[model samples]
Target: MTESDLTSNFPQQSGLPGEKRTDELGMRILKAAQTMFVRDGVDAVSMHKVAKTVGIGQGTLYRRYPNKGSLCMSLMQTKFDCFAEAINEYLRDAANATVFERLSRVVSSLIRFSENDLDWLKAILQSGTLKDAKANIFESPPFLFIRDTVQRLLEEAAAKRELVPLDPAFASVLITSSMTPELMFYLFDSGYTPERIAERYVETFLAPLFAGAGRI
Candidate 1:
């Protein structure tokens, strides 16, 4: 199916009181599913189990989310929104900081988010919604947000003579692509902590770009 077809398949409730209740129930479903997934692992949690946890009927839950992947996408969307807001706030607060420092903080924030939501992210990737989409994940909002942020930072650094002359657009893609959930999960399985991964990622992938800038 086309990307638009996939997106449009998801339910979109309207109206006031009904919409409010639907939103509340949706939040409850997400919370219950997240708790179960984090505690029992995604493979161990069933939709029936999630419905039971949320005190909703299986049919009710199914109406909202046809499958676990759909539910996971909703959960990931919630987390991504908050993460994006936090990154925006951080950037605003650190506007005067060196470009490298801002980039480091943003990248580290992203790593922390990935580590925290690992299971949900894994389920989303495997769900086929993204895999089957015509545009794929590179065109997804979350990826675009990070890529644009990184690209803007790189451009700022270049303007300040803090970064080496390079194509910010391609460089941003290189940096953001490296932080995919698949690679992060591999690193985690390889016994690397999020902090360690973030550190090494900054040092290896980002440091050379701003080598002469000197860390503040």
Candidate 2:
């Protein structure tokens, strides 16, 4: 996949609430699945195992999540919400910061999330069911939020004469292209610390824009 394609933008799926009892049961099933996946690895966990672990019938588990992909998507939804919230919070707090500084902070946050959730994300991407579901990661809500945030930053910088004129959408894509899991993992494995990766990312992709500004 192209770098842009690899950058997923899936929306968070919300659980339906039929009744209090059903909601509680669904929570139990989801918790069991998460626990098992973390303890035994995603590839080793199955619907049957999760049902047995949660003491629920296989049919019941299937009713909630027809396949591993559905369950994985639900699991990731919560994480993505938190991730999005963190970025929002950071931007709010850094309102007075320079565009470069704000961009650096966002990059740093993304690197931290990638470092912490690499395995979980890998499992979701490797799931055949998710692929078959044809969920466009680029259209996902969290991704869209990140993309829009970056675009806004780029536009702001250009408006403020801190960056040369450019298409914000294209610039946002270029910035996020470096934040993909594959590239991030390669950099991590190559002995680049997360901080170092963030620094280099800013230096390579952003510094020149600011340095040359109108000249560029």
- List per-candidate RMSD values in Å: 6.6, 6.6
Candidate 2: where is the Cα deviation over 4 Å? 1-19, 38-45, 133-135, 214-216
How much is the lDDT of residue 112 in candidate 1?
88
- Judged by lDDT, which candidate is best? 1
Error of 2 at 5 (Å): 30
Candidate 1: tens digits of C-alpha lDDT, residues 1-216: 222332333345667998778777876787777778767989899999999999989999999887888888886776677678779998999999889999999999899888987877788777765666545768888999999999999999888888877999999998898887889999999999999999999899889888866643
Full-model lDDT, candidate 2: 0.75
The 0-to-1 C-alpha lDDT of every candidate, in the order given, reads 0.83, 0.75
Top TM-score model: 1
TM-score of each: 0.82, 0.79
By summed lDDT, which 10 consecutive residues of candidate 1 come out lowest? 1-10
Q: In model 2, state the lDDT of residue 15.
A: 58
Q: Considering only N, C-alpha and C atoms within 3 Å, which residue pairs clash in candidate 1?
A: none
**Which residue pairs of candidate 2 clash?**
8-137, 9-137, 9-138, 9-139, 9-140, 10-140, 10-141, 11-140
Mind giving the per-residue lDDT tens digits that candidate 2 earns over 46-72?
Answer: 889999999988998888887887787
